[model samples]
Target: MNGCLTDWPGFCRQLQYTGERRLLVLSGEESWAQQQAQALLALSAATSTLWLGDAPAGQPHSPTGKYHTALGREYQHLVFNAFSGLHPDALGASAGALTAGGVLLLLCPPLKLWPGFADPDLRRYVALPEQAAGLTSRFITRFIRIQQADRHVLSWQQGTPFPTLSLPAGTLWQGQQDNRGCLNPQQRHALAVMLHSARTHTPVVLTADRGRGKSSLLGRLAARLLRAGKRIVLTAPNPGAAAQAQAHCPVPLPFIAPDTLLKAPPPADLVLVDEAAAIPVPMLLTLARRHCCVFASTEHGYEGTGLGFALKFQPALAALHPHWRKLHMNMPARWSSTDPLEPLLFRLLALNASPPAPPPAGELNIQWISRQQLLNNDTLLLQVFGLLILAHYQTRPGDLRQLLDAPGMSLAVVFRQRTPVAAALLQREGALEQTLADAIWRGQRRPRGHLLPQSLAFHGGQAQACQFSYERIMRIVVHPDSQKTGIGSQLVHWLKHNTQADFLGTSFGASPDLLAFWHHNRFKLVRTGLAADGVSGLPAAMMLWPLTTAAQTVLPVWQGSFAADLQDEGRNMPGDLPHPVPRVNEQQDRQRAHDLAFYHRDWHADRPALRRFVHRQPPCPSLDEQQQRLLQAALIPGADPVVLAREFGHAGQKSVISALRRIMQCYF
Candidate 1:
């Protein structure tokens, strides 16, 4: 007690230095902090105290003893019991209630609690002190380390009575208004349904195209929750989306960090997540366990994981809660419904746009070639490279290795005279046993042939036998010069007809053309993900085609397994994890923007305007005469001077700016 009391005057002085403001006591019982809080309250009548304990005035059944009445209320001093595990949102809300220059007190572990009680399935990942520090750092201006006790004078039984809090204003959100912003009726409707629904556990999903108002809807719902006196926490791929939602809500306290809300979650009434597809499925599950939450996502866009969303997220949603509602918004919010830009955007994305071509009725002609022979040809490599570059924002040289070495599948190409007209890259992917399947789900990166054994060792949580096989499309490229001649569709038909595997699967960056094309080819919607591939930082869509009746029979079983895991356990269960998609750049830094434009939708023919832009620009060292010829061949209509200069030759910075200015002239 001597050491604890030694800093009494210093504590009072520190509180005085912080001035007459709010104080948050986070479940720690320290003699010094108690004395300091007492001294401060005695000295200044303006200060008030908030006590969060296991048994409150109301809510007797609350597991954490977290009372809802204290939510959204400002307090001069809010303290937690030494053993309380506050809800994350409540912790954030409590922090928000603090005035500027306010002091927050924290104390943890009465020694008697060391090696804290463990559970059968999962132990708490965080501790009380660590949780308190996380909240203090986010909302408080400064922290003064007070004391750490050696042993415990106070003790209580496990689950005796320690309650958490709900912080509605702790999270910071920022975004434009709906009237001044962009959103459609379906998007708005989905959000409203989530907002007005009963507070009981019910999952909700909002899926749409890029610029379709999904994120905006989340912001609107968060605002409604704030006004309803609920403690709401908003999270996204980054702080930008989180802040974007906070801007719409006027809650007094909203939390921003993961630890702030996750460690000691306050009593949260609702949570709104924007760009849900962009977050990894594991993190999404962790948040969803909170009970009442709304997730907004984009389908078949850059930010969404495309097939990952369909194959993974959709089932996860189905298993997330007993009653989950869904809505889709298709119309574009940024451009006109019939804008010509839509077609161009779709082409640039390489999404599901083309239907599969039919097989020859009678016999093989000069235009047709055997799949085995096609694999031997080297000329089709250009199409492969170009398509890969086009579909991804950052396809590295390593991907080329995977394409060349993928398991199974001989290749095929169709030619018009001497030049290569179209091409398709295919592989065998499924029919794996539980061991191998679990490994893939768990995330054991492997080459095509080596996938089985390595996955077996990784997934069983120990060594086990594995047997699985399936055919997958490694890459499918149609020469840009002859894109619309129906070559792309022919490739789809050939793969389905030729593959020996029961199920046919393809994983690639999602784009509008690719999504619609697969849908038309009888490939059902499975998953959606996010990425910054096609200048449309929307999520990608993943779909599957079953080539055999046997495969179809097991498809539902596979789906059931995934759904069960998500509901009962949350996130990836067997060895698979949900990959995160990239988001759109709102800050729009100029350099990153330029790089994004090149990596986005189109690498070769993504240019919107021709003449002024090409001729008046600086050039990259990578572009040579042969590349220039290829570009010229790919450009529609004709390449302009500005288009060439900006896209090809090396001009000075001034010329690049000039070319840019010229391109902007078309929009006007």
Candidate 2:
């Protein structure tokens, strides 16, 4: 594709070789892209416009009717000025709006020439050839590279006569003057307008298409503010975007990450936000919480969308902070003028102005199922765990084993469609001895498993063993898509229904969200205790819920032993129980039968690994001792000798009898 500006006169002559349908005028602000668009509209063409200002402050009533001008023509151009910045989608959507082989004209300067000009905002400009090629690639059918042209000067500015279109010898003087001067006349006008905004907290926006000197004005403003001891702070989406200000400023400016702005600011009086349009609204909320700030953005051209900027964000700013001041720089100080690729750049990168709202409750589909179900299917397990990995900071392979083997561990997954969208890991607790119960109440060991001696020492508790029942919750992760959607509450309710345990409990890294969720569910705050997790080193809460009349029977016994254990601290031991001797009852019969079946099935299944995994966790209560206690508790129900001597591992019948009576006292 090749052509000269003067190769044709008027619209008809230009259309001879280049169809008037799609014309590309590479003449910056002066480019005839708009003029050529008007000419195409005259011939009943359809057009999609991308303006580089913020999305039209609010919805600006677009020019109506199908015909271009008032001539009753059929051409209808839907202009989307992506004021925020360029968008790839908006560009594609815009191009698609044109008729078959409908013209797509791009207006902007080449990338190579931008640096030669002295504009500080040259960083915002995209390489014209690359952007044009990308657009052509995306909308192949409609966009054909009809022509490519280049020159030292962008467009003629009245009396400049070197070659009809080229700049005159003295034109460089004007360029030099605009480059180093303190905010050109147009920039000064914008800044003065900023002072009128009622919002002293106003964001002074210096917006324009690429090469319009937005950044240069920002740098000049920073230098002036800093010299005035106003404590100017300059920031951008990244350090590279702020490079111009950093290089041009007399003082060394430190760059900070956009995320941690609120807590770690370096005490500044004025904040200068460069390339403000590229950042989303949440970031603007960050700025609003600050003292004073200036937000500078590129309106149209190669930088980003002009229409989106004017339409989407400006009103948000107006409503959120009605006093914001807006300044638009209409003059170009970089290279000669605007880059031709601005329209295409805006179209592709700045299509959607904001994110769509979350799906409504009625529209949301939630699935509830157990971990065992997920584990049986390899695909289901992978999908569930994969979602967790994405949502959580830490989830490991060990967790899968824990889910399968841990006696108390269980899971409930929430699904959107067939996809598991959220999951929670639960731990169903087992009975605890008085000594063990005491240690837990005292915040002694983390999760009680690490403190084994405490279980063997306390001799004054028998009935405490019967009533102890609890369940502990472990990791609870929800999909990012469904977070804050009451899905977590749904999981909690599901757990309560499924487990039907006396008490539900858990300890985890303390987060406000987690804490609030639990608190909302009537999970009371009990005493705090240590529960070692990977991230949080601090102790977590120890809570309980009593389900049966047995709780009334056992609470006092456990409390007494717990108090005594705290007093004893490390100073106690009980005589070992005699060799196990079994007695029988219905409960014992059931437990013995269940255990025997489990052992035989495990042995026959040849699953030594699973057996080991289970045994290693919760240390399956000494089977022989367990059988002896079951037999004794069933036959000698009132006698402490049975529970104490067998379960507590006491050597003599006297001590066992004494422990049993003490525990029984609480129930009586």
Each candidate structure's count of clashing pairs: 122, 63
Taking every candidate in turn, the Cα RMSD to the unseen true structure, in Å, is: 29.5, 24.0
**TM of each candidate vs. truth:** 0.33, 0.32
In model 1, what lDDT does residue 237 have? 57
Residue-level lDDT of model 1, residues 330-434, one tens digit each, is 865433343232333232222333323323222322233433232354334434344444444333322332343222434555545444445555554444567
lDDT of 2 by residue, 36-63 (tens): 3344334533343333222223423332
Q: Kindly state the number of residue pairs that clash in model 2.
A: 63
lDDT of 1 at 524: 47
Candidate 2 ranges beyond 4 A from true positions? 1-138, 146-173, 178-183, 194-201, 301-313, 337-668
lDDT of all predictions? 0.43, 0.42
Q: What is the Å distance of residue 137 in model 1 from its true position?
A: 50
